[model samples]
Target: MCSHYEAPENERLLAGFGVAPDSKLPIDLWPTHMGPFIRLRHEEAREDDLPELEALTGQFGLLPFWAKDRKLGRQTYNCRSETASTKPSFKSAWKKGQKCIIPVSAFFEPDWRSGKAIPTRITRTDGGVMAIAGLWEKWKDPDGQIVHSYTMLTINADSHPFMSAFHKPNDEKRSIVILPNGLIKDWLNSSVEQTTSFMQPYPADRLKVENRPG
Candidate 1:
């Protein structure tokens, strides 16, 4: 599961992904922290009108509107694609179509080849930004304050050539859903069944990794 990531900062990179250059967002993000997300805002749009994509920052972990406390968000930072539509933490967002896209420059994982974990940064081969699929929720705190949060969606990676190498030796490998530029809109608008098709490992040839020394 993705716990840390770099947010896009270059104007050209943001433009390439259809993100507004003026959109406010943090440059780095970690689980349970604030991060940027792109989604169609429909506060006033007609049912037949298409809402424009907007950038907004929210807590990385999703907090269901019915949640009693924000602390639960920490454990919900990553939602498994296989159970997102059925899991208690993410099911409501999935059913309510609270889809979103997280613009990331890179994400970190641990490589255990040396019999210990080494933090490794993974990026696109072309060094462009990647769009990670996610779910969002709006929750009202006890103070009546509304807070928006989100969670990254992940899929099984045990069969993937590259993704399978991460995590512990015996643990099931998992990979985030990195959406291609052409599929961003669909991810934000597609029905639950149709959206399932987007959950897959990114091509290994299009990715590169850099290991951080201990």
Candidate 2:
């Protein structure tokens, strides 16, 4: 599961994701950091109207209605696709169809093949921003303030040629679901049943990785 990533710049957000640019978000994002995500606009329109996408900044981790505080976000940043509909922290968003796309320049994962943790940056082979599948939520805090948050959706990557090398050697390999440009719209409007079709891992050949040695 990914815990750190680089958010796309305002220009990329507009050009690549087709969303209004916002310069307030930080470039580097962690579990509880606020970051931008693209989702279907929640506005009233005619039945035949095409869905509109909007960009909103939200905490990186998801906060369920039952969460007592924002601290819950850290542990809920990555939701496993296999149990999203059943997991307490993610079920509500999944059932409500609160799908979103997390636009990132790159995501970092740990490579332990050298018997040490090396940070590896993964990005699209064509140098385009990645559109990762995610779930967003709107939660009310104790102070009566509304807080928006999101969680990246992950799928098993044990068999993936590239992704399987991340994390520990003994741990189950996993990867975030990176959506193709053509599927971004369908994913935002997908029903629970259709979600399964998009949960597969991104093609290993289409991704390139840079190992950061420290």
Candidate 3:
């Protein structure tokens, strides 16, 4: 699961992704911090057909509409794609198609081969921005103040040559879904079945990695 990542500086990345800039996001986005995500406000024939996209800032962890308190969101920063449609915390959002795109310049994972968690950076070899699949939810507190939160969707990575190496040696490997640039809109509007098909391993050859001391 991706717990931390570097959100792109809006202007530079939006231009690289050929998207028009809308809002600013924290350069270093953490689980509870506000981060930028893009979603279509209305249905569109094509991604570019929309004059402007909705770029909103939301907390990284998804706070379900039914959640009694915000603390539950801390454990939901990432939702497994395999069970998202059925999981209690994500089922409603999944069924309602509360989808969004999380753009990142790079994400961090723990490499545990040394019996310690080594911080490892993963990014695109081409230096382009990555669009990660995600789901968002709207929750209101007791005072009726609304809050928007989101979760990155992850998939089993046990069979992925590169992704399979992260996390604990004995734990199951997992990775967040990375959507191809042109398919960003497709993922946001996909049905449950189509969304499942998009939760695939990114080509290892196109990924670049840098390991750092924990």
Candidate 4:
């Protein structure tokens, strides 16, 4: 599961995702930290018309409608694709087709092969931004405040050539879904039944990783 990632800069967001956010975002984002995501401008637009995408700054973790507080996002930053449609914290968004794309410059994972945890930064080999698949939601607090949040969707990567190398040997390997540039629009407009088709692991050949020590 992914717990941290590097958000794309404003220029990269505009150039890569074609949407410019109104405010500057933190470069490094952890669960509950503010980050940017792209979703359809109109949730209820007709299928015949092409959808317009919009970028918004939202909490890195997803907040379900029933969540009591924003702190709940800390535990929900990543949602498993296998159980997303049934899990309480993610089912509503999944079922409602609240799909989104998380634009990240890179994401960090732990490498445990050397008997120690080394922070590894994963990014596109071409030096482009990664369009990570995600889900977004809106929550209303008791004071009538609306909070926008999102969660990265992950799939089992136990047999994946590269991603399987991360995490502990005893733990199930997983990876966040990275959509190709051509599928960005299709992903945001996909129905619940069509989402599984886009949850596969990205090709290892197109990715590169390096130790990102602090």
- Clashes in each model (backbone N, CA, C under 3 Å)? 0, 0, 0, 0
User: Which runs of model 3 end up more than 4 angstroms from their true locations?
Assistant: 16-23, 43-52, 212-214
Q: Estimate each model's TM-score.
A: 0.90, 0.94, 0.90, 0.94
Off by over 4 Å in 2: 21-23, 43-51, 212-214
Q: Comparing 3 and 4 by TM-score, which wins?
A: 4
lDDT tens digits, residues 122-159, model 4?
Answer: 99999899999999999998899999999999999999
Alpha-carbon error at 189 in model 2, in Å?
A: 1.2
Name the weakest run of 10 consecutive residues (lDDT summed) in model 3. Answer: 43-52
In model 2, which range of ten residues has the least summed lDDT? 42-51
> What's model 2's TM-score?
0.94
Cα lDDT, all candidates: 0.83, 0.90, 0.84, 0.91
lDDT (Cα, tens digit) per residue for candidate 1, span 1-214: 8888988874744576545535556777887777777787785753656446777778888998767888887889899988888999999999888899888889999988678988799999998889999998888989998888989999999999888888899999999999887888888878877878888778888888866445
List runs of model 4 lying over 4 Å from the truth: 43-51, 212-214
Q: What is the C-alpha RMSD of each candidate to the true structure, in Å?
A: 2.6, 2.1, 2.7, 2.5
User: How high a TM-score does candidate 4 get?
Assistant: 0.94
